[model samples]
Target: MPVALEIVSPEKLLLSRNVEMVVIPASEGEMGVLPNHAPMIVLLRGGTIAIHEGGKVTDRLYVSGGFAEITPERCTVLADEAVPTSELSRAEGERRLSAAEAEYNATDKNDVPSLDAAMDRMQSARAMIEAAAA
Candidate 1:
């Protein structure tokens, strides 16, 4: 049986499909969810969401922060921001990475919130770039 996966952002629903498996970037680490998986809610980090079907990866999405609810039949992702890897341009990713690095460098080392936000942006950009390359 395939699992129903939905990825939504504040602005729109980015994806709604049935996937054989999904790999999410959980705050604790990476998590792979399959059909009939145990129910849980996890905090997502900035990274790629790999969608698998028929033992092959069908899609990759870059998600920056969010929460995911997984159950036996479905997985729902409420993302702070979600961008399809196919839509993210290499140049755009590079620009975002550079900007984030610059901001991180300029911020005070003691500024935890600013540093975290900058790091998140950098990670998201890098994930997007990597996804694009693959």
Candidate 2:
């Protein structure tokens, strides 16, 4: 049985389909969903979200901050930001990661926003790395 799965962002609906499996980046850790799975609501951490269907994979998405709702019939992912793994350029990811690290190292103790921005950049880069690897 395939479960309905949708991954949505504020700007648009990234994916909507029926799939065999959906791996969620739950707040505590990773959680896999399949048809007839138990119902639950979960907060997601920043990471890669994978989907499997029809013995083929559509694509991997690097999502930052989200919530997941899984039911026996459907799986829904609401993310603040989501970008396809293929969309991430390997060279860009590496370059951005380097810049973020450098910025983080240069930031002073009171520059919270700068630190956070740097962290987000690094996280995004890491997600791209994971997606590309997969």
Candidate 3:
């Protein structure tokens, strides 16, 4: 049986469909979701979400960061940002990375929150660059 996968960003609903499996970049690690999978909520990192069907990966999307709620029948992702991997631009990613690097360098080390946020941006930008290259 296929599992229902829904990926939504703050701007819009990016995808809603049934797939054989999904591999997500969870905070703990990569996770694969399939029909009848156990229920849980996962924190996603900046990386790719691969949709599997017909014994192969049919689609891939890059998520900046988000959380996913998974149940036996459905997996719903609420992403901060979502874009098709094919649409990712290496030049854009590079620009973002450079800006993030500057922000990180300017952020005070003692300001944990600001530092963390800057670091997250850097990570997401780097992930986008890698995804674009793939």
Query: Highest TM-score among the candidates is held by which one?
Result: 3
lDDT of 1: 0.90
Off by over 4 Å in 3: none
lDDT of 1 by residue, 66-91 (tens): 99999999999999989887777888
lDDT of 2 by residue, 1-134 (tens): 78899999999999998888988778678788999999988987778888887776666788867798888999999998888877766676677679879988999969899888778768766766666666
**TM-score list, all predictions:** 0.88, 0.74, 0.96
| Residue 43 of model 1, lDDT score | 92
The reply for model 2, stretches above 4 Å from the true place, is 99-121
lDDT of 3 by residue, 32-110 (tens): 9999999999999999999999999999999999999999999999999999999999999999999999999999999
**C-alpha lDDT values of all predictions:** 0.90, 0.82, 0.96
Higher-TM-score candidate among 1 and 2?
A: 1
Q: How well does candidate 1 match the true structure in TM-score terms?
A: 0.88
Ordered list by lDDT, greatest first: 3, 1, 2
lDDT of 2 at 26: 83
